[model samples]
Target: MVFWLVAVGCLFVGEASSSDNKITAKSIRVVMDNNYPPYAFLDAKGNLQGILIDQWRLWEQKTGIKAAISGIDWGEA
Candidate 1:
């Protein structure tokens, strides 16, 4: 899937560019549109939610990397 591809690509790029070919960063930043609904959005409680949010959480657990996921207005994005 596209998500997996992008995640892997990021890892690859990180490794490829590092002096020791390793992922040196402890975290990654991800931004998404807050109004996209099911894919990504702010819930009634004003928290990030939806499929992308879930996937990113899982990715964080699996990769052991903190993902600072945030959302902004689509137009601003």
Candidate 2:
């Protein structure tokens, strides 16, 4: 009985380890106007830099989520 219990435990551990190896790609893309201020905009160097970017970076770090920013025209987006 003890040997059977040990074998079952081993099987469960093996299954758990294998299940943890699965990889999934999940991300969120954010589009905002490059001309807008505070909400979203680009800096002098032509990089997306603003309050929203800082907020999103913190959110991504805390939630383990990937994020990307793209420039869009105000009329289009």
Candidate 3:
């Protein structure tokens, strides 16, 4: 009975330690101007595509996170 209890305790401790080593995904939100040219701008069809957007895409790909841009007037930003 003592051996069984020790074995169960060791198993629980190992599981707990493994769980502690697990990684968690980070949640992030970035707000940017989708109208600023060169840095960030909308395409002819009003799609967000620019230098900054490209950089953001690279960042998202590296970090395995989703990125998005919303259009807001200059004054609101």
Best by the TM-score measure? 1
Candidate ordering by TM-score (highest first): 1, 2, 3
**Root-mean-square deviation of candidate 2:** 7.6
Range of the 10 consecutive residues with the lowest summed lDDT in candidate 3: 22-31
Query: What is the clash count for each candidate, in the order shown?
Result: 0, 0, 0
What TM-score would you give candidate 1 relative to the actual structure? Answer: 0.72
Q: Report how far off residue 41 is in candidate 2 (Å).
A: 1.0
Worst 10 residues of 1 by lDDT: 15-24
Q: Estimate candidate 2's alpha-carbon lDDT, on a 0 to 1 scale.
A: 0.84
List where candidate 1 sits over 4 angstroms from the true fold.
Answer: 1-20
Which pairs of residues have clashing backbones in candidate 3? none
Global local distance difference test of model 3: 0.78
Residue 48's lDDT in candidate 3: 76
Q: Flag the better candidate by lDDT, 2 or 3.
A: 2
- Estimate candidate 1's alpha-carbon lDDT, on a 0 to 1 scale: 0.91
Runs of candidate 3 with Cα error greater than 4 angstroms are 1-27
| Tens digit of per-residue lDDT, candidate 1, span 1-77 | 99999999999899877756568789999999988889998878999999999999999999999999989998887
Model 3 / residue 36 / CA error / Å: 1.3
Specify the highest-lDDT model's number: 1
